[model samples]
Target: MRHRAIQILFCLSVLATFAAAQTVVEGSVRDTSGNPVSGAELSLHHTPGNTVQSTHSAANGTFRFSGTEAGTYTLTAAAPGFFSSVHNFVLRPREPLALTIELQRQERVSEQVEVHATYQTIDPEKTGSSYTFTREDLERLPDPLLESSNDLVTNLMPGASDSHDNFLAIRGTEFSLHEFINGVSFLDNAQPQFNPGVSPQIFETVDLMTGGFTPEYGNRFGGVLDITTRSGADLGGHGDVNFRGATLDNYDINADYGGQAGALGYYLFVDGFTSGRYLDPPEPRELYDFGKGARAAAQLDWKWGSKDAVKLLLMGGGTSFQQPNITDDQLVGRDAQRHLRQETGILTWLHTFSSETLLATSVYARDGSDRVLPTTDPITPYSFASRAPFTLGVKSDLSRYWHGHFFKAGMDLVRLRELESFFFDSRGDPDVFPAFSGGLKGGQASFYVQDHFSPLPNLTADLGARYDYFDFIDTAVQLSPRVGLAYHIKKTKSVIHAAYNRYFSPPPIEYSLLASFIGHNAVDPSQRVGDVRAYTQNYFEAGWAQELRPQISLELNAYLHTGHNSFENHEISISRIFVPINFHTARSNGAELVLNLKQWDRLGITGRFQYAVARTYFYGPITGGFAGDEPLAAGERIIPAFDQTHTGTAQ
Candidate 1:
């Protein structure tokens, strides 16, 4: 009877785990001697595919994480002077027993090796007009705005404004895309659209790939951002607290750490934020934008049987954003209130087979919803929201550090559980507010292979291609080829660099839905004109990098770009939706000048000046497709959206 009762209770606890409405995970890290070590970078990978979070250790050498969903994961940490520590861990409703770490530092008593050898880290001045900002910079610097990474990075650009107080445009480009965690794609692909929705507490380093990019990158027509997250071990029990307020109160607390030399190591973290109340002057009425959110991510690593290491990670979070109602009589076309809520969960496992190769697989889910009270006269739904586009993928990497050629080969299998876009409704039909759904079950798949060949000490070349298979198209393949050459003027601390490449982008799903709602009048929309063909862009850049001194530098780049399959609004249709009928070829040329002055510690300035001319030739309206070859009836060239004739930025 006793044994039977015990089994019954165990079953009950397992079932209760899922109903907790929340999950909790906790662990720690240490050195081989079982002592706390700070500044270790840690990354949490969830199951299926989305990135959960990454963080670094605090002064106390400790950490803690909570509010997690049940799943699998792998945690990895490595420091410049220490050996790598990889851990695997799991989670439930409540199953964490204070973990510890005992790391083994590489005992190298011989010739020293400098680990930071990247182009920007080794010498910022040699790169001309760029400056790298570690997390430490954001800690000491003061930002007048709140919860905006884009607003901050752009201000640091070579030719940005001292403050983005208004709708500021750079050089002629109205929007700039910033990548998250080293991803090639910006979090929100649509430029100039924002709400300061991201929280910066969960990041590592933000690299500003402003210009002179190699062949690996595609089109944004402006700059590239490469972000690397913190994936090191906790090494000790330490955490931190940061808070800032504008119209309300914002508070946050974070803790995480790892275990000792034992076969099992662990890490955990938890954070949250809430706001106060305020008002807007437009309505001359009281307003309140209240937001509350929380997150927890943790991991454990298990290495057994000598050569095998398995890592487990569990992550989950919830957030809520709301606003008070606005009265119709008090304003024009806007909303009275808005509410947004999202819940996320992730789990992952990474098994390492050898020193030169590893396989990582993960799964992640996001349940996001929104509500709004816009005017009844609006054509679209009063509230815009989506719970689709859930992501899933698998990634693997093979690397070999040989004598003359350093090689790394990897591939990512990505897709969406829902349609590429679930917000579209054709036939001028009304949106099913609060019930937004994407009709796509299979979106797109991307595959690529790249090689880095260095024939000399200061010169490097690369070649690669990305093939994408989308929902509406048969197959889209982009051949990306690029080369870079740099020369260092021996002892003068100056370098010159030149690069050339091409980029491609297909019309996204949102444009398709606009077509569905096509009407007979000027506002008519359709499902994308004649299954539009592929679009391509060519890029060319040449620049010089000069380091006058340790704290000062300058860079100048001249560029030219030409595009194929350019889509524009068809003159025959006054509709805001799409009609793929109107098409054109484009040409853009520009030059940028960047200057840096960090010569004086604690007091420095950086800025840039840009000049570009954008023009497109739209073939006249479609007549069996050949008619588009003629110029538009209006005869005036259309200016590129990114074109900003004379623009400047400073920081």
Candidate 2:
């Protein structure tokens, strides 16, 4: 009967262990003589988050850390008559680990030992293929074009193709497709051109993910550009200023000020620049075109307590430029000048409910406007258009760990408004073409949940799904699933990773409005075009990374993406107005190889090579298959104008 009762109690305890939400870490501390070191001070440090927990050893040299999250941590022990020691370890979700540490006597003759602690929260596991750049890295890169811009950094990366002047095409896909600032969409007005308005002087770090992105990021088929700005806490209570000038009569000025007092901190940044066009021109014309822009940002941070914090950010910028209209390799009398402005405000709150649970919430709004003014030359036929796009959004995310599984769930809601107008001619004549103007208001919502499961010490799997809904599209709900696997070979310090994901990109709100205008003349609103749908793609990727030596590494990856129902502009009867239509399907495939070597930290060398193939097919002539081809047919394939077969870069 006694043995049976003991067995029943053991079963009950095992069941309770699986039901618990928190985890614990316990260990013992001993001196050089293998004796219990009671009252020794121990500190636990959580990387990236910088949260700290401390306790003293018990009378039996045992220490217990209860209610702690699963993550990478650094533990340190310090006591009198002994040298301090540090250890780095990973805590698995809901798993208890026991460890022992032995301290040496201070009197032992020894030399100083240097220890380096690096916090790499961006890619802790090194399972993804990406490149990270800091503010200093951006300044040292060679520039033959004599331009200081973000594009310079991306164009040099492996697998990057840039045939166009400003756009960056990766793996044969569209350029500048996805951009994020602090995990939120930053560039919404991407049609005609896409440019990140933030200045590099204020950027703390930039990460480019070419493959193996997490499920939390969606809505783009290409790569992702993640940018994080600097905070006032980084500078403590100081200010900085910088100025750069080149031979092309170009000049730039940037300034910043930041400081902290008590529990509050503040930061401010401003930049202004002018790129003189006369120094370098495509052609020698009597006329000239120049570029000018300015950017400014401010931030405030507040710490309520050990478990709560708040951050507020404000940013605004404007860009203006002029381009000469060229016909038959000659300058035309009429030129085009454009001005664009963007502003954004955001507030974020972070609270730690417990060691095993953390919550983050944010509210943000952004606005963008554009104006185009052309020379009023009667002979030249010019178009005038103006637009104002606004977005208001709210987001909330919750993270928890349980039973060796890390879970995250989040949702976002956004409202959009676009006020726009356009005309065929800007010669101050109404007879040329009647102006078309309208407004659109809509909203979008998304929810996602992801789990990072570790079934073995060397293997990890990430599985997740996301659902998106836009009120303006015919396909109201779209679902996307993502999965990735990673394995670490302990002996070789190498990693092998693979992933498969489904991607969806809803047509831009501005373009959707253009499609709705197809029925502007119809008396009944229900008769308007109703067949419009969002784009979808399936992506497959596999890669391997290994460090050949202490300062040299190599990486190779291959990817393929197949997409359908892609959106494009099709002219109607050669009229001035163009309507958007989903008229084509495409396939893009590519492979990349990169070799990096760092010798002595003062000089670095990098080489990249890539090969890509892209082809598009149209179903029918109504979808603008081919205009003047003699063999025009219902189903035909052709290469896009932007597609490039092979590209390479070395630096």
Candidate 3:
């Protein structure tokens, strides 16, 4: 029955991709001097429908509108220091219209224009620190498609660092981050150990929030990565292809195409690559680490009517890499290999009751699996592990803006099933190494409500709460509260913000079940593990931002987190399979400084520095795997393995 449901969903997604027709409008915004005008606001008013659509010009001054009804329309473009431009045109059904609008400089600005410019420069509604990278920003990076996205984050984001085993650690927190693609959880289905690969070109925008998040987001304490995929809307049949080659026989080929036909729009991307060196090796010279992988993604949008729209996104990929072995281990011919596969699909419906009110609902499914081929070497003997996780979920969000307040509410429900197996040939050392296999079925539900409001012209506040419930090997429930505030000082061109959030993160179901099994049935009494518990945290942050000039800005922020049952992962021996462990208490504090210089005519600079301290105390016997018996002495504070005291980056 489950398989049938999935099949039906897939079929619908494919069928919906071909069903609609509408008009498209695309253009670029430029100044009188022939320079591109970035961040220009545009509005299109339809005469027949008496409706309006609004958008902002991209960094390259491009803008597009898709799925519009054939009618007479008036288009207006406005910027902070330019005179607004207006154009009137008639559109035909199933046809695309293009234009280039130019804006003229204005000597004096009105009070209203000054207010608009201030709002554009500093977002008063933002209560926390965040960084956003557009598609153009990523394209500037060298070999973006050839490297993992983690490299981008660690290099560009302040307080972000690379942890051991290809994991990302933010603000001294490791293995506790959440990744979401188009409002669906990706990390939950694909564990970090598998190192799922995604091309940067697939993303339209990547927003990383380091602190001051609202209650609407849950399940992670380190940070939140919100990603929006590319779409065909407003792109009038545009495409690109690229090929890259380097030393060591490494090569990559990638392409993307997007366009709109009538009411239907589509975007497709595919990438294939092979490399002589994949995973980082312990030795200077990589050995037995050849890797290859291919991935493809598609997005379809159908605006069947003026008030309703449907979007479908599908992605699937697989990778295979040979695990490198040390020189001594190479003598025994250790040739372990790891293979990973993942597929995700999401269908969403959007309804617009009015310009100020909207509702979006989505149904998503995800499947991920990892297999590690055993290596039979004399010293290490044999090692093997397999994991498969399936997820199905439904989510909905309603947003309404009234007066000076914006209100949002959402709910998410998910069903999870996981199958995992591990085996290690102890070679007469069964006391420490054992084989195990297990499967689990579980469900999770969450509901959240938040409000962003301006009590004063320069002061904004965000208040919200959320409820989360989880059921797998055990049941856990939490009610968390969130609060944030931002105050802008017009005289100084500065903003001060602060936030407090309570977070709840449940342990992964498969890992928790495995820990339970090991604890109950251990070959040796001393090796018995204990039950894993959910992690909870209280996070606080405060920051200040100053606009030094029109093109330069500086920011400083500090954050602290106190957590219980802190989550951690550890690999078993030399095998790549990782297990979850918990500490009794965890504390982390950090501060970061950032400087940015933008729009200097083809030149940009960014610098960041961070200092942090992280410590965990009171180790647990339960769920610690082989370290079950190694408990910390009372009053002892030890830094986490992934902690870094100081980090700095300049780009």
Q: After superposing candidate 2 on the true structure, give the runs of residues whose Cα lies further than 4 Å from its correct spot.
A: 1-127, 139-153, 163-165, 186-196, 276-289, 327-330, 426-435, 473-475, 510-512, 515-532, 567-581, 597-633
Tens digits of lDDT, candidate 1, 212-282:
44322333334544443333243443455555545556554455454435666666656665654321222
Q: What is the C-alpha lDDT of each candidate?
A: 0.41, 0.59, 0.70
State the lDDT of candidate 3 residue by residue for 513-628, as single tens digits.
66666656666676554666678889899999887766467788888888777766666667766676767677888888877653343455533333434333334333343344
- Against the true structure, candidate 3 reaches a TM-score of 0.82
- Top TM-score hit: 3
In angstroms, give how far residue 14 of model 1 lies from its true place. Answer: 18
Ranking by lDDT: 3, 2, 1
CA RMSD per model (angstroms): 13.1, 11.6, 8.1
Which 10 consecutive positions of candidate 3 have the poorest summed lDDT?
111-120
Q: Estimate each model's TM-score.
A: 0.60, 0.76, 0.82
Model 3 stretches with alpha carbons more than 4 Å out: 1-8, 11-122, 187-192, 283-285, 428-431, 602-629
- On the 0 to 100 scale, the lDDT of residue 439 in model 1 is 49
Enumerate residue pairs that collide in model 3: 21-262, 21-263, 22-262, 22-263, 530-622, 530-623
Per-residue error for 98 in candidate 3, Å, reads 29
TM-score: which is higher, 2 or 3? 3
Best-fitting candidate, scored by lDDT: 3
